[model samples]
Target: MSRNQRWDFVRNKNLCYCCLEEHTVRSCRSKRDALLHSYQATEEAGNATTGSRRPPAVLFHGGESSKALFRYIKVQLYGRNCYINTFALVDEGAACTLIEKDLADELGLDGPEKELCLRWTGEISQTEPASKLVNLQISAANQGATRYDLKGVRTVAHLDLPIQSLGEKLIKSRSDLKSIPMPTYRNAKARLIIGLDNIKTRENAIVGVPLEGRELEGDDFVAVRCRLGWSAYGRQCSGEASRPRILHVCECNNGDRLHDLDEAMRNHFALESLGVTVANKPLRSKEDERAACIMEAKTTFDPEAKRWQTGLLWRYDKMILPNSYPMALGRLRCLEAKMAKDPALSQFLMESMKSYQEKGYTRQLVREEIVSNSNSWYLPIFTVTNPNKKKTRMVWDAAAEVNGLSLNHALLKGPDILVSLMGVLIRFR
Candidate 1:
């Protein structure tokens, strides 16, 4: 039939031209089906190009799913006498690797004992005294040609990984994850933990691939490829009403500064033996005497101002200071930029500097003085704040070095003149 005749026939029959249905062409089911098919084809093509599919949505049992996932692998640990194959957890969050104490003993591994404080989840703490540390070699259970050495591996009583077992049905369904070797029925116990020390090393790099579109009994997982071997880690659904258990272990050296404490105690007791003993006067070197004589000659008291003025005690009479004007100018420009951003800080700094000037602590340099002093040092100034007291103080940085010398380095260090606190307290009593 012609186009006009077909259209008229469809209109007269009250049917859709696209599907020959009773509805109009605008609401035809065939058009919607065609669009849905096209979208599915595009998604399939994208998944094929990426060699992975989108992960399936998790199927909740009752209200919510509390399944936990952890990285675990089968490894062969080589000890002194022989080697043992066991499951190990790869935790990059852990600072150090750990092995089961019983397993360590079985392998005849021995090392120096150390005291460590172990902290676990739920604010639990344990002090492990004389904990043995050992060195071991580890390799993949399937591939043993390449081995990685783990040094200073700590020993723990037990390493528990409370994760559900991976069934063979899940592995057989996915081709990409079929290569991963896992236990048959029961979940293997994780007797060892490989920490960040091994995972971060270039020799033992690890890569992870999410096992998308691979779900069995509402469980999702990811496959990890490392120097060890292919391993699977993800949420495991047990169809039970229980919370997931995750193990997080941290260890630190327990009171390693006992030797320093013992030394301090000995010194305190020794001081008690010499009661009311007078300290000998410190002997002055020729440099100290010269510096003292120079200070005495240059120092003068102003009767009107009620203040004393003195010149800097130079280490050498002929040594000239390097020009620090450029450094000081750069620092001042940086400070100005910062102060522009904070008005309160700028006001505080100005007030502090004005106070210093009023107390005769600092003086403004004249144009003639700056021109004459070509090789003079410039002390940079900065502000420090006490957060507890909510107070700001200005500091003059005399320790800023220029050309391997600073103001502090050029000046002479006088003899110790500070009185002991114990002597002062005794005299007051």
Candidate 2:
């Protein structure tokens, strides 16, 4: 950010706190000085941090670089840890914005320690700004005049097979990368993976909540992480101290309510004020995550399409909705979810809160598509390994230190894959 930009944002001191502009009431030097009878603007801004909220983990997937996203969020949180993974690109586009719309989209060095240049930064939405900047590109691509545009969410190949048919298509080892039969993509696109691990998240925690054989067995549902420390930075911000953080204050669901989420995210997170088109059975979360190498999330929503869409996005902080409701309303709902954490996700033990309001929890299954050398590979959640096959690392937690069970081909392909996996679980902190 430039020195002038900081001054401009600081000049307007009555804007919304979430806006993260220099134009907040607390940002005005005169007003700030008058209120506190002191002049510690830099120090004050320096000490600010995002309140207790876990913003979604951002993974930048574009043909360009971004900076505005980080700078804006930094000012928003004052000073908090928001984990971000930036993927540098030679081409410039805004594919990443769809997922990281809450962040900025700039690519360059602001030169030296001038973090104040974020004078008028705003939460970027492709629905507006630079006009045909995205439209023309998309139009051209569709017409074959151009090569790529962030529009027209990429085409996904979804194929459903009988459980037995899927069982026979398994491929073993990295060397078997080419042996797997896979579909193809004409170009890149926005993607996410939806996996139904017998897991649950209560109070932003991940745990195991299995089922005998059903969709989302009973009451368990996935919850967005509300608080997390920034592990590393994809790039550096000027005059930076500690890495930045984010706080999400969104709303989510208890189980598979696919239809509800679809409606909510329609015109909500879409471009040109247009509504989001629903795509069912688009492969699986694991496949999309591995094949696309972009931002991905996993959740379990109802299969009825029009009925319920409560899958990966359940328990999200819906604070950014049109109305200006107290952040607490959303918080309280998530609080209810927290009380319902599963054992695999939450290290914090609480036996009384097993089922969410006695609804019980059910497990969701997702297929994974892996990629190596620009090709695709398939693996079901409960993959049966061949004894002669090598090993694949399997973890129950996000933290890498947690020792997890490995896939032993012989036994996995022999008797029961899921049952054998249960015995290999390693306790972790």
Candidate 3:
């Protein structure tokens, strides 16, 4: 029908803007179904594999602080993406709400038309009244729900799918560091997301070398996470606001610090665990490697030489567990297979990896084994060997694993899921 052929003034939205009703277009329930189906197809078609977290779920383990990190990330990646749900573990007097609004906010996520926080604290004595703040936010939330004209993807959920800066100085300037390489998809059409999932050591505290206000005694469960994203994306993709296709993720113990010193330090720890040694000798001054660590190669700082020094390292003792952190270095390599257009970045990433290698580094891959007969679950392991360190070991257990899931998932669902006392780290662009 023509605009002038409108039988009614409001135009039959039920009939669609093209003048085709749901019945006319197809016997589907609504256009949403069609849209959702389209997205599912787009994702599946774009991806050739979906078996091993083709896009690994970057899991974290922490308390409220986890929420803060997720929120920071969400605000940066809202629209055109969806942050999945979270589940919190109980402790102290808190019920451990698995989901939260802080995270929802970054993505303009307002869970449920009406919701309430677990009763623990009293209402604040604000002049405007909390009730009004809640209502206004809810209103804005509703508008955001249908704001984006999503295309080239899937359908809608009951709710619209929801979904950082860094440090200064002591850090190397962009010019100081080498560039990471990226492959060009000159022929590849449709947008592809390069995602990174991060997870920390402790859910309520920092994972790396311990700091203030943490309950983890080193005897209890420490945290471990599996983040997924492209290294190129790690440096790109601020959010939908920024016209970037790469998706960067930093999953750790505390808040999301695009550039947090403490978190960055741990991130280094992760890199080091992979066998990237900054110093010639092992870090005997620091904590021992956990039973399930994977060390990569080894490297050290030689400012005097003004060049990256590289060598490989492996575990020396069976008692010492090597360290390992997964890097899309694997994906970056594949990307290199076709295109090496971004030589600057490719070189930079390799330098960092080389520094990590100085200590004794290697790629971390998932290895599955049957620990029990029931087949209830198979152990997922990553192995690393650094000559300077001890022998290699496997990384797996219930506490760290479950905690990683709960903490990271919570990040996807809250503003400040849990308040953490861990030291923060920042990643520079």
Candidate 1 structure quality by residue, lDDT tens digits, 136-244: 8888786545777787889887666664556687567666567556544356678888876666444443421223333344347556566676667666444444564
Per-residue lDDT tens digits of candidate 2, residues 189-265?
A: 22211112101222323211211211122322111111111111122222223323331211122233577667776
What's the lDDT for candidate 2? Answer: 0.26
In model 3, state the lDDT of residue 346.
53
CA error at residue 206 for candidate 1, angstroms: 5.3
Q: For model 2, what is the alpha-carbon lDDT of residue 79? A: 9
Better of 2 and 3 by lDDT: 3
* Candidate 3 error regions (>4 Å): 1-111, 118-166, 170-429
Q: Per-residue lDDT for 1-429 in model 3, tens only?
A: 433445353244455433345445455444443322345667876575664455756744433211111111111123325533221111122211122234334444332342222122332211111111111111011123312211111111111112322222201233222231211111111111111110121233221111322112322212222121111112211222322221121112223333577777888768756953445544332112421132223445678657665432222322222111222234335547533676754565556556765755444444564232311222232334467885444333222233233212221121232424452333222
- Report the lDDT of model 3 for residue 109: 36
**lDDT winner:** 1
Best first by lDDT, ranked: 1, 3, 2
Against the true structure, candidate 2 reaches a TM-score of: 0.12
C-alpha root-mean-square deviation, candidate 1? 27.9
